[model samples]
Structure formats: C-alpha cells, structure tokens
Target: MSNPYFQFKQFTVWHDQCAMKVGTDGVLLGAWASVERARRILDIGTGTGLVALMLAQRSLPDAKIVALEIDEAAAGQARENVARSPWQERIEVVQADFKKYRSSDKFDVIVSNPPYFVDSLECPDRQRAAARHNDSLTYEELLEGVNRLLAADGLFTVVIPTDVVDRVKAIASMNKLYAIRQLNVITKPGGIPKRTLIAFSFSNRECVIEELLTELARHQYSEEYIALTREYYLNM
Candidate 1:
C-alpha cells in the first residue's frame, strides 16, 4: 500500500484526503521552479500542499505564498499540513477555484501541475478523475486566471506531458505568456522525454530548452535528479 503521508526533511504531507498523492511530477516542478528572488508566490491546485511547502523552503524567510486548491477536503488537509510546518505563518492554504479566486496582490511567480488529460478516459473515482482530467480545469481557464494575478514581469511555470507542451504553449501565448526555458525530462538515459518543465513570462525572448534524465538505468536514480531534489526526498 502507498504510504498515507510523505515525509520530507522539512515537513510531512498527509495525502489521505487528496485525490493526487505525492508524485514525481509535483516534486520535479517544485524543485526545478526558479524562485530565488520571489517575494510572493502562488501554487494552483496545491493538492497535499507539496509545491507550496517546497517553495517556502526555497524562498527567503519573509516570502509569503498562497496555495489554492478547489477541493475543499484537500485544501483543509493542505492547511493542516502547513500549520504543522516550520513556515506555516509564511504560507496560507485557500480553498477556492483558481479561476474564481480573487487577489489584489500580484505574484512574482506562479506554478502548477495542472490537469492535462483532455482526451483520456475518465477514472472510476470521481475525485481522481477531477484531479487528472482537464474537465475540472481547462488550460484556457488556467492561463486566464494566471494572467489575471501574475505580474507583468512575473514567471509562470508548469509541468506537462511532452506531447501536450505545444498545445499548452499555444494557449499560454494566447493569454500573453511566453516560454523562456524548458527542461525535458526523460525516464531513462535513452528514452524520449516524458514530461517538460516549462517556464514562461510576459516578456518574450529566445526560448531555451534543456534535458533532465531521471534515471541512469532501471531503478537507479540519475545524478541530475538527485541533485535537483536532494533537499526534499529523505532517501535522495
């Protein structure tokens, strides 16, 4: 059985109520997102609040973050996890849909592991289906919401399947966001990229593409993956 909670060096995430548990996609984005200068950050679909907590550990002490989760139970669980963390005061878990969420303050950085399976079959579980499928939150709506709260020069980063990267980029461009950098992630050294870590901003420029190999061989973690997430994963 999967563990009910994920224990990080800095905090623990109890995901019993979350549709999505602690997974690699979330971990990669949380570790790869550039937040060195971020004063305020926002995490859409916070889930077990993993990304928000990771950002809290990465940013300065005074940096504040808001974690928005549409699922009420997951949001409550995120709040509880944050309350039990070291930076509880620096992070707030809000229960609301990102498209409907209103905030006067602008964010320096926005990140998400959004629902991307638009053409896939639905899962049996309602919550998991909502969490995994685009019906719960479409790319258009996600970008529109991001555009509304993101500062003119802020960075918006997300992780999506390699096949869907183009579609997501097209939507982001429509919303006036442009890609700046991307990290194509491969499961093994010789495999095709399975996911892409993309970073975008309002100001468009020459886009940069890079690759990250997660494993050198079967079940053997790659050096790059270990370096990126060493701070969080206990066994790393």
Candidate 2:
C-alpha cells in the first residue's frame, strides 16, 4: 500500500482517509505561492491540508489560515494533520463547498492546486474521481469564489496543466483578475513544461514569467526545484 502519510520537515500529513494523497503539485503551490507579509490566507480545495500547513509555516506568527475541503473525510484528516503540527493554532480546517462558501473576512492570499483533468475518463473510485476531475469544481466556480472572498489587494495563486493555462487566464480575465506571475514547471532538461503556476490579482501588474525544472535527469533533482522546496521536503 502507498504510504498513508507524508513527513515534511515541519509537519506530518496523514492522508489515508483522503481521496487525494500527497503530491508534488501541492508542494509546489504551497512553497511557491507568495505568502510574504500575508496576515490571512485561504487554501481552496485543501484535500489533505498540505498547502494550508505549508502556508502556515511560511506565514508570520499571527497569520490565520483556512483550509477549505469539500469532502468530509478529507477535512477530518486535514484537521488531524493540523492538530499534530506546530502551527495548529494558526490553521483552521473547514469542510465546505467552495462555490457556496462565505467568509466575512477577506483573505490576503488565496491558493489552490485545483482539479485540472477536463472531460477525461475517470477512475472507478468516486472520491478519487472527484478529487482529480474538474466536474466537482470548475475553474469558473473556483475563480468566482476567489473574487468574492479575496481582499482588494490579495493575490490568488494556482497550479494547473500548461495546456490549459490560456483557458484559465481567459477565465481569470473575465473575472477581472490579471495574471501577475507565472512559473512553468518542466520535468527535466529540454523537456516541455507540463504544469504552470500562476498568481493573479485584481489590479493589473506586469506579468513575471519564470521556469523551473524538477530534474536534470531521471531521479536527479534540479537545483532550482531543490532550492524552492528545501524548507518542506526532508531530503532537499
């Protein structure tokens, strides 16, 4: 069986009960999203609460983080993971549908490693399918919630398949959100980028684009990836 938990430098995430397990996408979003000086953060579709915990670790001592999960089991596991972490006091795990979620307080930063598989054949497991497919939470719904809950100056960050980057950008544009920063993630040297990380804001800013290579060769991690994730990944 796959390991039920991922052991990070600062926390342990047990995901046996969650449909989604720990993965690099969540780590990338957690570590790469801009969190400097963020006093309040929201993590949408926090399947295992991985990103939320990472943000808590990166944020200031007084920062408050909310990890929203649509699945009850996943939320429970997230709560357990947060409870065991050193930053438990800084994180709250909420089980709610993001489309209907309401928060009186605006967030300084919002992040999600959202489902990206579009119209693909789904696996038999219903929970895993929900976690992996976009049917449960479309980019439209996700951005709508971001628009509603984000502070005027807050940034919304997401990691999605590079193929759909333009589509998402168009959706964000419709919502009056502009892409301010982007990071293309390549699997290896000279390999095509498969995933793109983007940070959007209500106010237009000059878009900054960068690239990250996960490896120089198979099983050999690149320096850029190591440096970006050194704080959370034990081996790095």
The true-structure Cα RMSD of candidate 2 reads 0.8
- Model 1 per-residue lDDT at 48: 91
User: Model 2, stretches more than 4 Å misplaced?
Assistant: none
For model 2, how does the per-residue alpha-carbon lDDT over 149-233 read when each residue is reduced to its tens digit?
8999999999999999999999999999999999999997888999999999999879999999999888799999999999999
Instruction: Please give each candidate's TM-score.
Output: 0.98, 0.98
Task: Kindly list the per-residue Cα lDDT of model 1 for residues 146-204, writing each as its tens digit.
Answer: 99999887999999999999999999999999999999999987799988999999998
Residue 125 in model 1: lDDT: 94
Question: What are the lDDT figures for the candidates, one per model?
Answer: 0.93, 0.93
Q: Which residue pairs show backbone clashes in model 2?
A: none
